[model samples]
Every structure is written in structure tokens, then in C-alpha cells.
Target: MTHFDVMRRLTGPLAALMVVALAGCSAGSREGDPIPAPSTSSTAPTPSTVPAVPPAPTVAPTATLPPPPLDPLTPRPSGANTPKVVNVTGTVTAGVESGCLLLEGYLLVNAPTSLVYEGVRVKATLEVRPDLVSTCQQGTPAMITSAQRL
Candidate 1:
């Protein structure tokens, strides 16, 4: 036979063998599916001696998270609508609450008035009301309704 004819004869048998092998390999490519095998007896196969597989779990998983933390402890009054009061010494300066009171070491407290000079030093007993909207240097507001020079 010619060289081309010899190659053709081999190709037919090789192609058939490849198709059969591919068919066998594809039988078990899917997950959770049994691979088929040749069986001789017509009777059903006996159960394996291996232990039985337990059923899949039915309960769903749960996620638990801790409660959010509490807010910072603020200086609150004994009752509602009660104003915070304090007595501090500082130089008079302009502030949002009006004439701002500047303590030697403390943050500025609003004292808003022209009667006190820009840099006058004084010791004052002041009644500071709780201001929800005032933005002084400190977190609180001090309204010095009464004052006396030291």
C-alpha cells in the first residue's frame, strides 16, 4: 500500500479508540454521580459492609454580635432643665456666649459683655446655663451673670 493509504488505515482505528476512551472518562465527570461499571449478574448488588453515611445537617448557621458600646459620660445635672454652675477666675475675652471668660489654665468660657476690658483679670461666681447650640472653646458654656474684681 502507498504511504498515504497506510496512514489512513491507522487513523480510523486510532480515532475509534480515542472516542471510546473519552466516553468512559465522561461518565464520572459530574459531581455526586456514581461511575458506571460492567456487571455480570442480573441480581441487585449487595450493600457494602462500610458504615452508613450520616444525613446532611438541617440547622442553619447563626451569627452573634455584641451590643454597641455606651456614649461618653457627660456632665449631666441632677434633673432636667437644671443649669450647670461654676466659679472660675480668668481674664475677660470675647466669646460666643458673649464676653468670653479666659481662665489661666482652663478653656475659654463665654462671658459676652463690654463692661469688662479685653484683658481685665477678675474672680467671678458665674451661673452657666446649658447651651445646646453654643460653640465656645470648651464643650460647656459659662454665663457670668454676676462678677466681682479680684
Candidate 2:
């Protein structure tokens, strides 16, 4: 127990096992070379190096509407004009030349003539024929008589 205390306990456990084996051989060397292994598998995710998140922005589709136009004195039924007189040219939004006879009210051509120029808004049995409502003149160009169309 004394060859100098067993050479100082074998040089302090051989200098702590040569400083833990030179700190695990200087953590895998550069000065001692050798450390490259690591790659065990698992990678796949590269649609072009992946990191472009921009494919969720594009929406513009919705349009559908058209249907409304039909009204020209609405009254057909009873042989609906069974080959009778039904001229109907259309234009005179509302005339009234009453001294002899003229009372017109057309607008049945392309239809929708904004309610045929007010003869007090028509209807009263279509102004009860004051000789065809006087002669109905607001613009001019009629030919009327029944000529239904509604």
C-alpha cells in the first residue's frame, strides 16, 4: 500500500481513462478523419424542392338570366280571332283623335312598350272603345283592332 500509494492509485485511474478516451476521440475527428455515415432512408417529398404553397386562389363563374317580355292586349280565345280582322301594327303608344274616330293604343310589335303610353294606364275594358279609345296617339304608327298577344 505504499509504493507511493500504489503509484498514486495507478495514476488516477490512468488519467481518467485517458480523459474518456480523448473525449470519444475528439468527437469523430477532422484531425483523425472518419465520421460520415448517417443516412438510413425516409425522404421523398420533392415536387420541385417543395415550398411553393400557391395553388388555392381562382374563382369566377356564375351568370345566367334572361326571360321576360309578352303583353299586347291580352285577349285571345273564341276562335281567337277565327280568321277575323286583327291588323295590329304597333307604335302609336296612345292616340285619341276623337272628332270622327281614331282612338289607338298599339305597342304590340316588339312588345314591352313600357305599358303603352298611358291613356290613364289603359284597361277599362281597354278604355271602352271611345271609338277605339279616341285614337290613341303618343308616338304614332298604329293599325290596331283586337290583334291579341298578351
Candidate 3:
């Protein structure tokens, strides 16, 4: 080839190589800013381009309950004091101390004289102190200060 043809060919390939190299260098930088270095900090913040993770869930609240009521006339079975007159309804289970009849039937009655009676069905308005009613169970024998069979 001639000198002019050789020079043209050389210049064309050199210009193309320079353009490719310049394109790669420019890609590493923003419009006017420098490229950032790799982070070394253990807690380095993530780039804003990435999405953030969400937080965990929580539990709801609850309510509480109240206390029970009190009764006065019902005597503790283990105690010595003879119970006052109280009307009860239960089957005749056994005979208790004193003249108590130990009603084993549906209704039970406790008289002031330490007498207890068991009946299949007993309806008696016993003269029981209001304070002792809370301790009485459905079938518990109570001291019947005054009782009238219904």
C-alpha cells in the first residue's frame, strides 16, 4: 500500500480504541460526581436504590375477673359451735353430731336444738342470719331457728 493509505488505516483503529476506553471510564462516574469506594465499616448503610425490610408484629391486651361473695350462717363442719337455725335442701347423707338428723334427701333443715332433718322435698323459711347465707351449699344442712313445712 502507499504511505497515505497506511496512515489512514492506523488512525481509524486508534480513534476507535480511544472511544471505547473513554466510554468505560465515564460509565464509573455520575454526571459531575466521583465514584464511591467500597465500604469497610461493619454497619455501613445500604444504598438508597435498594428497598428496606419491614418490622415484626405485636399482641393484643386482655381483661381480668372479680372476687366471690360471702355467707355468714353456714357453720364449718369441723367447728364446735352449734349452727344457728338455717334452712337447707339436700338428700339425707348421714346423721351429724347432737340431735341433728343428718338429712340425706333433697332439702335439709337445722333447728336451734341441734336437730337436722332430711326430706325428699322440703320448703321451709328458716330464720337464718343473712351473713351466713353465702357459705351454704345447695345441699348443706342449716340450723332452722324456725321452719314451717310447705
Report the candidate with higher TM-score, 1 versus 3: 1
Taking all chains together, the TM-score of candidate 2 against the true structure is 0.18
Candidate 1: pairs in clash: 98-112, 99-111, 99-112, 99-113, 100-111
Write candidate 1's Cα lDDT for 2-113 as tens digits. Answer: 9999999999999999999999787754554475455557675457755688999898668777534322235444564455557877776544445444554333343435
Write model 3 residue lDDT over 6-96, tens digit each, in one string: 9998998999999999997777654555766446677745688567767766656566553232333433455444435545554334343
Put the candidates in lDDT order, highest first.
1, 3, 2
What lDDT does candidate 3 reach at residue 110?
40
- Where in model 2 is the C-alpha error above 4 Å? 2-4, 11-13, 20-22, 37-150
- Estimate TM-scores for all models: 0.32, 0.18, 0.22
RMSD of 3: 21.1
lDDT of each: 0.57, 0.41, 0.47
Report the Cα lDDT for residue 93, model 1. 56
